[model samples]
Target: MGLSSRPRCQLAEQYGPVFTVHLGGQKTVVLTGYQAVREALVGTGQRLADRPPIPIFQLIQGGRGIFFSSGPRWRAARQHAVRTLHGLGVGRAPVADKVLQELRCLVGQLDQFGGRPFPLALLGWAPANITFTLLFGRRFDYQDPLFRSLLGLIDDVMVLLGTPGLQLFNLYPRLGALLRLHRPVLRKIEEVRAILRALLEARPAPAPGGGPVHSYADALRQHGQGGDPDGLFSEENVVACVLDMVMAGTETTAATLQWAVLLMGRHPGVQDRVQEELDRVLGPGRPPRPEDQQALPYTNAVLHEVHRSITLLPHAPRCTAGSTRLGGYLLPEGTPVLPLLSSVLLDKTQWETPGQFNPGHFLDADGRFVQREAFLPFSAGRRVCPGARLAQTELFLLFAGLLQSFRLQPPPGLGPAGLRTVPAPAFTMRPPAQVLCAVPRPRGR
Candidate 1:
């Protein structure tokens, strides 16, 4: 509940700039400024690259996937993940087209509401389906049972990870294990692993000579044949990596989109300006294209402002791989470090009026879109999100497409003053369930 609670910037004032938090008998130095974050994440070499041992990820992933795995195994898997995403058109037109299609579907769904107050119950599904299609070459109907189950399992994992009990367990692993206190958590992890295992086992093997199989599963099956070093590309890695992709790619994008909708509903002038820009640029008949982003500076600024205003994951955990000096403190090998990303986003020195919802933060005097170094929704350095580029493209396309087709507004009598964003508090900082009205705009207006 770091920044998930009301008055989200309280921690920044209380902690000054940097502070220490003790967890699991470890000292985690929290970097609150852009300079400090750069020093810890970018300046330091692999000395700060390793991840701390988390019992849940370790138990389910078995140190196979990119998120939980470390050292050489992590390096190989991450390399493969980046390459596979690129080959599959992650940032390119193919993926953008797929996202556009999904945005069309979302627009249709909104239209069906007919300006009624209907909750977008778990809007994460749209992006989740996109990631699923990209990784597994499959998409589930919105009401599909298996799809709902997968989403539930993912939500459970995120919630469990953020629980105070789990944090305490990370500190006192032996004691928690001695009491069999984490059995329920272990069971949930097993459930997800079992689901992934079944999916992996059901996949058909690649044809002889690797005649170009589709999907990450197929790619892993093909490369896993020769037995990668230490079996890093084995079935286990494939399952874990696929899970990582879905988990990482799905909720974060969806949550950010939720924030966008919420923020727009709160500010009609900002929303009107965005719609005007969309109307002037793309018009109502045509869908948004990636190239059009350059022409839509205000729209792009709003997107950036949304990311800056609401950070998805406030802090990213890192551990020192070797001895390193940070901010005049000598940190030993394996010391835990928490890069306070929200602090950076809300750093007064870097941002003018850091607390307000102002799109001007991303715009220069001439009204050109300018990216700030401190504006990093996706963490920086070696372990930066592999899906950053892909997610950005999707967000832009989907956001633009939706705004172009329909006007998002609050329900009658529930104006901007009534719209409040209560934090849902999980692995990500998501807005709580709320309903908004989507009024269809005059076609081609």
Candidate 2:
């Protein structure tokens, strides 16, 4: 996963971009390359928007929440989430301020290491705290027990979801149920649910005036009180939504940052270039802003390359909402579709150098940042990620702010090549458990 290539490249070349692959008893259509995957997602629109029942998630959410739910329920949950996020200033200056605050917290934590090696997992703390702030209207201290516990549970669930036993259970639910393969995951899930339930219980009722939701919890509360006949905002659904939001909102940006840091540490030349750009644009004393991305083209390209290279949520399988023609093939209703995003990001025809860590892919000869058509890190269509803007803002400030403050590199004894880049097998393509040193940069320019 840490490598710049995907095996699906060969598969697509041999079998064409669109082909059917069997995951145990399930037959899922795999869409590879930019054109094929985009057709299934952007071209087909909502026809491929629904999520098919994956056994583990079905057991966990019961077709509730934004990520896995379908039909009217999913639509309503997603719409409300988008509105709530905007109301809370997710994509605006307010969000940049909040993210910058969290970034300072992260930088402080990293500084405490005093040039000693620290686990890369520490990078995730900032993004997770941002999500927590949105969900609970507050953030947790780095030493808080609840914060550590929630992160531990999330880590456990992510690793468990990618385990072979769970994969088998997802493929053959009834048989795996008899063999008891799902108990571990369910146990971890219950632990997380208990924490969230307590949090929801502790929330004071939404204040009068039906004002815009300040937090995700308040948003769900308002949704339920709107006399929701469909019961979309029931207690259980709210819990599911919160969990989904936390899991989805936190993991992607966190994982991508991990990748960015590692990539920077691995390629010192590239890191030097990015630092130079940061120094030139914002100088040593000023903090990085989201708006700085326009002026700092090299740093911006580096971040975009991070997203393009990792392709975190590669196979976020979608279910055919109805019978439709995709990539010249007819798919029946409910056909599970694997829109292989990794394949698209690394498409030979799309990227100039598909297997190298080059930021020039996002740059033109004029040395300005250029958007590529294949940079669909957030996916597309009706089921597209609602938190895209928030994620970008978080990434921009955190990445820029960190490099602006500290020089990221591997441990003293461990050189760049000594650091392992292969992602630990997890639901998300997160950097493997590794260590890096954040040496404080000089105060004077």
Candidate 3:
């Protein structure tokens, strides 16, 4: 938490980008700065592609799902998920329609407040529902008991997974497990699995009209039944895979959306520019499309800035697939490496203003969008986020649509300066809890 404002990059000044940390019983390497992280993750290439065995994730996934799994299982499951998610319209225009639909639903929810304060958690619903639509082939009602339960369980899991107890367990598995430190989150995970099991069983015989909804579950069923190879598609494995997609697809995207709302509220000048661009290009009530990004460079840059500045996953752990040398350091096979992505995103050499919320980081002199090499929020190389395009599409539409429909602001007795932007404790870097007013806009169409 102390590192929130200080940033881990400053540590590089004292220890260089490639330094070692001795955590109780484990000795791991920390890769700071853009050059060092890139050299380790990209330069070493496939040899650094494996996920280190973090005890917490091992308990949750058991090396079965795509997000935390390694070796052939990770490779094959990733291949299958990419093909299936693409076929389900993840990176294509068809999914944009569904995202826009959720935006309308979200707008309606915000309209309920009528310029009153609303909880920050509500912002997660739209993005999370979009993820559910992919996993179960349907979206859930915001008020549904099952939907509410699932979200609550996910909340518990995320917090628990980031708790000190979990970290202690990771460093000393046997001693921590003896004290039952892992049970709380593990119990919550089981509850989630129960819900997933019911959803799998209750699936419609066919996919409504498209034949299996998005049919991700159905695809897994068929894949498991065939060849009888490694049992990667077994019923338990299917549950884990679906669990990975739901958790991965929901939390970070929703967190980013929350940041968008909070940051726009905090910086009204930036919000005004975003609103002007949306109003001029998209017009009132038109809803944003993926293609609209080309014409909405300012809005695009703000959204990108939100991501770059936040540094959601500060340092994702990667294990060496085999022994490899990086930055003149020789690492043994299976060594755990902590690559500081936050440093890369905020590299002094990369951004003109590393600490400020400057959309110009992604803009040229003429204000056209420009991709920077250090803008690696999704990381890179063999272990890059497979759903990167899907996430980008959701973020652009949801963010643009929100700005089009309303002006986000802090509630009564609060001003923009009072709005808290501190990093909250979670598996991912979450924005602090806040209640803000989403005042509706006049269409003037």
Candidate 4:
């Protein structure tokens, strides 16, 4: 089945442009058409600003983090995070430099594989490392015990969220609690929270007369002082916010990178074109810079294509703040609403040849790169992904740098490129396990 044939997108397309799905006793209105999504997410504003209450998130984060929380707590935390990211130069040169350094390290690691089919598991490490640097003012060795533990925790949480049992629990929380079946999941949450608490506590204190610390932790500390002076920036909030950053920043970016390599292996001609652009713009001896992106239209287009093909996180779950009209239907306040992003992204109305992996979707008649309003990978409106800018910077740098240094291919004996991606659903969608051979290119090739 094609990617769009997945149950979620299929349901969205079949149920008119906007309709409600009854899950347990709750009603979730899902928006499929572009106009409907805009109306629900942007036009109504705060009416659709709240998030659906996920029991797992509540048990794990205590509903204190920016992603799940609402009202004053969410506003303060989200504002602080955005401001802190700006202060750390997230979309500027300093952050780009950091991303480029990690990309270089990643290229070196892939080069070590000597064109053999190496697992892409290692590919996840670099982006996750970059996130750690931004959040804690430090990076970890690939084999660091703490880093490995954090990755494991992330994986477990994602699996739990995706499991059918969890969905059933979300639908019937009282029964789940009565049978004592959720105890294990609760225990896992506590364990992860404890580790996060320790890490936040152990973070180094700012030095005397420090002008501004560049880490996410420093931002939290600064915000704690004035913004939430009454203890709203408590240790729990700090831990939850930091964990949210690490999980959101790392997992989604890494998964996209993994998909890019897989797609390149399946379509060598496209891969070659990307490499050609990298060579012409970056040359062989030096690494690619963020500014060089303007000169490499095809490479940029390919990255956008990968994002479109792999619609990360089928939809963004939201809730209505009050009774509002969307798609001519009355949606009551607190009603869950899912803006089906994949539908809008792959809608034939918006994209030409929506089913194919064509980079031209992002290009103009003259081959110049162009932006599409329907590109909602980060979703739209006030509740959009906070790491959107940061993730875009990382994706471009890492993808271009890798293609610049090596050519990815399948092992000779391996069968036809298996584009089959395992659907590991979570707060974000993830790719299944896969590997590819990364063959290093000769200098000045």
User: Which one is best on TM-score?
Assistant: 2
Candidate 1 lDDT over residue span 1-445, tens digit each: 2223223346546865556765556666677778888778888978888887776567667787898778998888888888888888887888888888788767767767887886845457778888878777777787788888888888787777777666656677787677665676677767777776776667687776757756776777777887577888877778788778777887888888888888888898998999998888887688888888889999999999999998788877788888899888888888778887887888889999988999999899998999899988888888888889888898898788777876777888888878777667577887877888878787632
Give model 3's TM-score versus the native structure. Answer: 0.96
Rank the candidate models, highest lDDT first: 2, 3, 4, 1
- Using TM-score, rank the candidates from best to worst: 2, 3, 4, 1
Clashes of each: 1, 0, 2, 0
lDDT of 4 by residue, 8-94 (tens): 567766777887677677766777867777777778877787887877677777778888888777878898899889889898999
TM-score of each: 0.93, 0.97, 0.96, 0.94
Identify the superior model by TM-score, candidate 1 or candidate 4.
4
Candidate 3 local distance difference test against the native: 0.86
Candidate 2 vs candidate 3: which has greater TM-score?
A: 2
Lowest summed lDDT across 10 adjacent residues in model 4 is found at: 1-10
Instruction: Please give, for residues 379-438, the per-residue lDDT of candidate 2 as tens digits.
Output: 887867899989988998999889988888989888899888777888888889989998
lDDT of 4: 0.79
Q: Lowest lDDT 10-mer window, candidate 3?
A: 1-10
The deviation in Å at residue 278 for candidate 4 is: 0.9
Runs of candidate 1 with Cα error greater than 4 angstroms are 1-19, 178-181, 208-210
lDDT of each: 0.79, 0.87, 0.86, 0.79
